[model samples]
Target chain A: MSKHLKHLLTYVVALLLFVFMGYPFLYMISTSFKSLESFFIEPFAILSWPLNFSNYTEVFTMGLGRYFMNSIIISVTAVTLVVLVAALASYPISRLKFKMNRPLFLLFIAGMMLPIHATLIPIFVLTQNLGIYDSLLALLGPYIAFALPISIFILTQFMQEVPKELEEAAMIDGCGHIRIFWNIMVPMTIPAISTIVIYNFIHIWTEFIFALVLISSPGNMTLPLGLQRFYDEFSVNVPALMAALTLASMPILLVYIFAQEKVVKGLAGGAVKG
Target chain B: MQTVSPVKTSKHLEIKKKKKKWKHTFTICMFIAPALFIYGLYVLYPILSTFQLSLSSWDGNPAGPTFIGLDNYIRLLSDPIFFKALRNNILVVLTSVFIQIPLGLILALLLFAPLKGLRVFSTVYFMPFLMSTVAIGLLWIFIFDPINGPLNKFIQTLGMKPVAWLGSPDTAMFSVLLVIVWQFAPFYMILFKAAMVGIPDELYESASIDGATGVKKFIYITLPLLIPTMVTSSILAIVGSLKQFDLFYIMTGGGPSNATELMGTYMYKNAFLSFNMGYASTIAFTMFLIAFIVTVIIQVLEYYRRKKGVFS
Candidate 1:
């Protein structure tokens, strides 16, 4: 084929693939807006009528609002602990060379590689023994552990790139280690910190396995669990389920839209390093 | 100018100053202590305890477990569903590494290409991955509804009849696989795109000048350069797919004959539903071992690959 033909062919194929890639999500958003009577038909009917938001209303009314709240609380806590702890932890590993530094860095990186499926049962049992099995604590603790390695890894990567002269100059002024870290390292890592925060947010937000295994208490369901529960109760209510699904996903969706460039750049390296 | 003290007291102050020279240790310890303690308490200990628990029978309702060496593993080997789950887990991993990578790369390439509207396109393509499993499960359930779903709707558009997808054993595994790929392709795409950015534009420009075309450029340049990342992402994808439970739980519930049950889902049923903590712990160990082995293999392979290459 001619180069023009090849380029055209590639572009055409891409457009088609893009549509196919997005169809289910498009179907989801549309179905989220579809009236119950028109749920299945609207896909073919081409929506000559006005879009409805009653499903959204029903979803909110039907306990998703509470699930939303629970998810926000758990995710916020998990992200907070992950960012704060990883920030503190990455300082020594990144700036201060010590014995077994390389090995210790590898250890945390290995944690990034370790799949938590292996650790699921023990978490469940541990939570039960601690008697907080159904509370947010169960969810909060593991998320911090699971998220630590990556947050630390990324922060260290960013920290290693900062100019050492700044810290050296500070040290010359009689600053203590904590002051140097808090005043210099922390501020210097804001971009990386925000990036880490967003990554942790998305991960904790979408994380399902630990939540699935540990959160047995219906009252403490996260968004993932809440959506699962919504599905169980409203399996046939396609519009409402679609609405709940859309709502469950929209926060991160918008977050991705606004921060996508930063997200993509940060993730490209971070993800494959896993 | 300092406070007047005896020579012996001055020596003690000097010792404290020497100790303070290792101050990074304090910051390091303080930084790592909180995360390490929590992780060690919650994550690391449980892994060892689960292994210990697997060696014995206990409903976990009691204060202690009865030691029964290797009995749970023996029983697990004898069970057919155990075999089924193992096969299914392997199938999920294999399909994900072999099929999903290529698919995700294709999508990533499209997003990277001069294709119009790249931003909107990539974002939409990445949406399913962003969607919670709960929502994706429900969406696929509709697609697999056998009557009113888009999968069926499009099938009939081609003048073919819609068949029950999730309703049959043979089709059920593939059904879940479709959802798996849909949900995770963006992860690889995002990773590959990052790698693509690192590639010097001149290499592609040089290739084009040599009369190299699209696929040729991708093959000679993109593929070779991305091998490390590809390998890394594949390891992640394989490990992740091995333990997938949310979709398996919400969609088929490991059903139509338990055909779609991965080890993670099976462990949940055993440990939580049936309260067979011992057998469940056994299953958990097997998964841990598999994940550990696979991860180590990737790291070693990457290590060797790095050694042979000039790059780190």
Candidate 2:
């Protein structure tokens, strides 16, 4: 094929793949605005005129808003805890000379491969025994633990690349390890830290199995769990379920759009390295 | 005016050194303690306990588990459903390795050559990976809906009979696998793309000069250079497929007569539905063992390859 033809072919192929990949999302957005009757009648239509806003409204009335809030809280808390703890743990392992640093780092790395299923029963029993069962707090411990491995792995690698001269200069000025870490290290590792924060936030936001097993009460259900329950209760209400799915996915999608570079680079970095 | 004795000065130096050493250890401990505590409690401890749980029977009650001593494993060997689930998991792994990774590599290769509007295409391809699995599962469930779903509608437009994609046992696993590939292929694409971008342009330029261009150049240059990435990514795909839960669970619930049962969903049902904690733990442990063994084999293979200077 001619060069121009090949380029055109590539674009055509890419566009076809794009359409294949994007169709569901576009269909989803359109369906959320569609009425149940229209959805049944014209399911394959790209658009439905006289869009129904009632599905969106009905989702909130059916307690999607509560689930949304619950997700936000749990995700935010988990991300914050993971980032903070991971950063703290990573600093000494990355910079300071210590006897057990390598072993400790490896310990965290080992945690990465742990199947969440293996820990599910024990975590369930532990949370119940600790009296945090059926509460949002029950999720925090596991989320932070699972989040630690990758966060620590990434942060430690990032922190190691940080110039040691800065820390040495801070030490010369009588700054302690904690002060130096807070001032020099944290600011310098912001990229990695933000990546950790975003990944953890996204992971915890959509995490379901733990939430399903741990939280019994509907009052504390996160978006994924709540959506599952909602689907079960209203299995036939396609439009409403679409609306809820869209709602559940909207924030992260928006974040991905705006912070596309950071999210992609960060995730690729973590995945490749970890 | 301030001439001190040698012993006094040496004593003062010793005290300062001791204090600094203690302070250094304290700082290290303080920095690491919180993470260690939480990780130990939630991750490490639970992992060890899972092994114990696997060897015993329990109903998840307060009465505590009783030692059954390998009964769960023995029973699992006899269980048909467990074998079915294992087959499904292996099928997922095989499909991911043979199908998803290669497709992802093709897409990545297509997009690798600098082209206009590729960024937008890349984002579109990757959007599914970022979306929640539950949402993806629900979306596919709607798409596969026999009566009102677009997939069936499209089939009907193609002059074919509309089929119940997820509702039928024969097609259910395939449908779920399709969704899995849809959501995850982009991940491997990004991974391969990253590795491909790192290949210096001069190599390709030289290859073309030698009249080894196009697929020939790719086979000789790009494919060999991408081996390490391929190894890592394939391992990722394998482990991920084995541990997959959310998509299958939400979409099919291993349903239509256990046609889509995976180790994950099987273990989940055994634990939560059947309340057979012991057997559930065995399944979970088996999952861990499989993942662990696969990972170790990959690492060992990578080690040997590196030793042979295969991709250095």
Candidate 3:
């Protein structure tokens, strides 16, 4: 094939794959705007013009708004708690000389291999015993715990590479370990911290099994659980369901778009290194 | 008097040093305490307790569990559904390792070439990985919906009968796998692409100069250089496949006579749906053991390969 023809072929192939990959998302967005009649009548059409906005409104009226707020609260709290705890714990393991540092770090690292299902029953029991069952508080502990391994791993690796000279200089000025950690270490590891925040946010936002198992109250249900419930309850309402899915996914999708580079790099870094 | 004073000074200095050491240890503990506490309470405790629970019969109630020794394990070994779930999980692992990774690698290679608008294509391809798996599951569910779904509509247009993609036992597993691949192949693609980008351009240039172009150059240079990444991604894919719960759970609920029941969903059903906590724990423990074993095998293989200087 001629070079130009070959390039055109590549473009054609790329476009085909792009459509194959992206059509679902596009179909979702288009369908959300579509009326039920249009959806049923012309299912494969990319878009039915004269967009119906009622699906978006209907989703809000159908308790999606409550689920959205619940998700935001849980995800934000979990991310904050995980980032703070992981950063604090990672600093000592990464920088200080402690006898149990390696073992402690390994302990957290081993948590990565732990499948959440293995711990589900015990956690469910523990939450009930602790009187946090059927509440949002029940999720916080597990979310932070599950997020620790990767957060600590990434933070510690990043922290270890932080120039020791800065810490030494701080010490020369009579700064204590805590002060140095707060001032020098935290600011320097912002990239890693942001990565942790983004990751934990997305994770806790979408986490379902735990949410489903733990929180039984309809009022306390997170987005995924809420969406699942909505799907079950309104099995036939494709347009409204699509709208809810779109709404549920929008926040994280926006976050990913805004911080695409950091998200990608962070994920890539964590995966490759870990 | 001078000798006595000198001994007193030494004792004073020793006490000060001891206090300083104590202070340092206290600071270290303070830094580590919060994470350790949460991790211990939530992660470590549950893991140990799950093992304990696996050995006993319980209804997930406040009442204590009854010790049943190895009965749960024996039951799991004999259970047909457990075996079915296990089969599904193994199939997922195989498909992920054999299919997803290779497909991802091929896509990565395609994008690695200096194609125009590659960035746009890359972003579009990776968009699915950014969305929640639940959302992806719902999206696929819509796509496979028997009546108004796009897939069936397309089939009808092609002059064929519309299949109930997720409703049939025969096609359910395949449908679930298709969604899995669609959702995750881009992730592996990005990983492989990152690894490929790191390969020195001069290697490709050198190969092309030797009249080895396209397939030959890729086979000799790109493929070999990407092995480390392939190995890592394959391990990731396999482990991920083994533990997959959300997509299948949300999509099929391991349904149509449990044709798509994975180990994760099976354990979940036993614990939550049936309230067979003991049996569920046994399944969970077994899942953990398999994950651990798979990881160890991969690590051992990686070790041998590294020892042989297969990786740079």
Q: Per-prediction DockQ, in order?
A: 0.62, 0.74, 0.74
Regions of candidate 3 where Cα sits further than 4 Å from its true position: A1-5, B1-13
Residue A98 lDDT in model 2? 79
Worst 10 residues of 1 chain A by lDDT: A265-274
Cα lDDT of model 1 by residue, B159-263, tens digit: 998888999998999999888888888878887777888899999999999999888998899888888777777878877776677888888988988888878
What is the per-residue lDDT of model 2 for residues B219-244, given as tens digits with 9 covering 90 to 100?
A: 99999999888887887888778889
Task: Assign candidate 3 its CAPRI class.
Answer: medium
- Chain B TM-score of candidate 2 stands at 0.91
Residues B185-255 of candidate 3: C-alpha lDDT, one tens digit per residue: 88888788788878898998988889996878878998888888888888788878888999999999999
TM-score for all predictions? 0.93, 0.95, 0.96
Point to the candidate with the largest DockQ. 3
Interface RMSDs of the predictions, in order, are 2.0, 1.4, 1.3
Instruction: Report the lDDT tens digits of candidate 1 across residue range A1-274.
Output: 8978878988888877677778887777777788888865665454525788899999888888888888899999889878888877788888887885687677777776565766777888778889888887888889998888888888888889879999999999998778998899989988888877877888788888788777876778888888888877787888898888888888988887888776665555466432
Residue lDDT tens for model 3, A1-274: 6888877887787778888889999989999999899888887777788889999999999999999999999988899989889999999899999699999999898777778898999899889889999999999999999999989999999999999999999999999989998999999999889878877777788898899899998899999999988988997889999999999888977877787777667666557642
